[model samples]
Target: MPLSAALLQTLHSIVGDKGFTTNQGEIAPYLQESRNRFQGHCDILIRPKNTQEVAEVLAICNDENIPVVPQGGNTGHCGGAVPQGGILLNLSRLNKIRQLDGLNATITVDAGCILQNVQLTADKADLYFPLSLAAEGSCQIGGNLATNAGGIHVLRYGNMRDLTLGLEVVLPDGQIWDGLRALRKDNTGYDLKHLFIGSEGTLGVITGAVLKLFPKPKARACAFVASESPGHLMDVFAYMRDYFGEQLCAFEMMPRFGLDLVLKHITGTTDPFAIAYQWYGVLEISTSRPNTNLQTELEEALHPLFDRGYIQNAVVAQDLMQAEKIWALRESMSEAQKREGGSVKHDISVPVSHIPDFLAETSHAVCNVVPGSRICAFGHVGDGNIHFNISQPETMEKAAFLTNWEALNEIVHEMAEKYEGSFSAEHGVGQLKINEMDRFRGGVELDSMRLIKRAFDPNNIMNPGKVVKI
Candidate 1:
């Protein structure tokens, strides 16, 4: 149902003319999702200036039983940010670095603060906010907290869910829950902040967050290593981690197919290795101590793996520019896939030990199902999260290839389930994986989630029909 005239006017009043918009042109960007898989419609987009304004909007929304989709930078892979109806609560105006406690190693910021801005602020303070993703430049910290986003540094610093210390949220009934305590340890009742973080705004709108910060790394070593086969990455990663330990930040894998896709499609990319290899991976080690010879450490550690015939060829980035160039190959996976054609992607996780076998088996299975289907498998192998993306067969029609989405999802997700891995890893369930909740996740686990959703959002006015169903 369309919002009543009075209700719309009230929402407009809640946020001044500058903060509210009914025009389709201005509202179009909010509806155009990151993946472009879904485009949502909202008659009005409300941009609240502060937590009080957000609470006021929610009070009106809850009373009218209006569905509100809380949106951040709208750079999420899942369509969780996209609203079905009701006015969208655009939190971009709330962007502000509220506080930065360098001594305590915490930074408090409004939810609308762009992730890169926070990172830049942390850098200025000689500290680090390690939750780094490709869309950091555009994505917001609130959405990151809401989705519990995981990026390359998850192996070291943990996901946004782990990095966050506290959250201030507006409840479904318009009550502002100020739980933003920047404490390392607080045994004060149940941790309510967790309910909103990674909740995908189904329960409440994340207004602000107190995020944990880490010591700035003085030096980071990067390398692009080639494995004889996909199966060898497990042994290779083990050798590197055993040597580097907590200093190891990331270990990402991209197949030759994925590399070729980037080379063929993207500009200014070069082949780091002299010969083409079947499987390629980028491993990084970071340390806070200054003048640490990470290159010498890498050389000493690589000799053993090289002698064992596990490593095919490798090149450590000589400088900052070279390091970024090496890292670019990994970051360009998604963009290159888009340039190629339709991609059916999976952000799933298995045991670190099972990654090699997982890639080999799943890739073979998918290719068999759809002949000529190019597999562009890559992502954070250090923590077992693989972005197993399958590009449509070049010869096949895009529409026809897309029809196999369910079939392909079944093949990939089923194998992940069989391997005791999660079907949805970093990317939350959102609308895309809602059905998978029943198929992969069931019984008591799902029951508890539903009960909590009903408890916090009894009316289900907050981000309805996204993560869970009643």
Candidate 2:
């Protein structure tokens, strides 16, 4: 159903001329995601400046039964923010830092504040915000909270759900729920904040949040280690986890194929090791105490792993610059795959011990189905989230390879399920993996999700056709 002129005019009145745009050119960017895999259409794009404006706009949309797609910074890998029809309610204009209590170790801000800006604000106060990712410079806090984003540092500091203390949301009926409490132990009934955190906008619009902060690390050390295979790397990870304990911040793994792609496509990046190995691991350890020689400690720790033959070769970064260079090899893997050709990506997770067997069996299964496909699997193995991405064959066309996306996804998702793992780990269930929810998560689990969706949004006007189908 098309939005009536009266409904559009009423929405315009709530936001005014500067906050609304019907121009197709201006609205083009908001209708598509960063990956360009999903594109949608909206009659008008509405940028609400504050929480009250957002409430008013949503209230009107709710009354008219109009579909409203709430978009954050639009950096999501899944198509969560892509608008289907009706109004595109963007939260970019709501950017503001409401409060910063350094002593309490919390920062309160509007949901539209850029993630990097929050990190910088915390840095200025000599504090730290540990939720970091590739899209931190552009992705908004609301989207991060909505998707419960997980980055490399999840091994130590938890994901966005753990970082968030409280949230202020505007429901589908335009009623504002003020649950923004910064208490560490709030045994209040039914922690409502969790409902919207990973709900992916199916419940309500996240307007503002109070996020937790941590002590900034005074010393840091990182190393890139080469191993014969993922199985060997897991042994190394186990030893390091016990040795470093709380000091261990990150542990990432990638195949040789992933590194080759980065070295070939990304400029000014050099291989950390002289000889290439089958698999590589990046481990980082940090301490809040100043003047700690983490580099020496990390170097001394690798000696035992070498003795055990768990690692083939290793390069411990002596300086900050070298550490970043080592991290670049792991961070740039996704971008490097794009330069090759069509890549079928999967954000899946399994038990830490099951990672090796899962990778080996899944790789074999994928290869059997799509012969000659290049498997570029990598991610935060410390937290058990692996980005299993497959690139097109050298001899195949990009379009032809992309057609195997669903088929390859089934094989990978089935393998993940067999290992008692989740198919969608960090990425939320947008339109992309809604069917997976039904296939993998059915009966009581899926039925409960639908019951909550209908209760919160009976009209289904809040991000309709997302997360759970009604």
Report the alpha-carbon TM-score of model 1 versus the true structure: 0.98
Whole-model Cα lDDT per candidate? 0.90, 0.93
- Top-lDDT structure, candidate number: 2
| lDDT per residue (tens digit) for residues 1-470 in model 1 | 76777877888888899889889999998898788888899888899999999999999888888899999999887899998888799899999999999899999999999999999999999999999999999999989988889999998889988998989999989899999899989998999988888899999999999999999999988989899776787788888888889999998999999999889888999999778999988999999999888877876777887889888888988789999999889899899989888889998999888887888899899989999999887889889998989999989988899999999999999989878899888988788898999997789988999999999888899999898888
Error of 2 at 286 (Å): 0.8
Model 2: lDDT of residue 400: 95
Candidate 2, 386-429: lDDT as tens digits? 99999998988999999999999999999999999999999888
Please, what is the TM-score per model? 0.98, 0.99
Candidate 2 Cα lDDT to native: 0.93
Q: How close is each model in CA RMSD to the real structure?
A: 1.0, 0.9
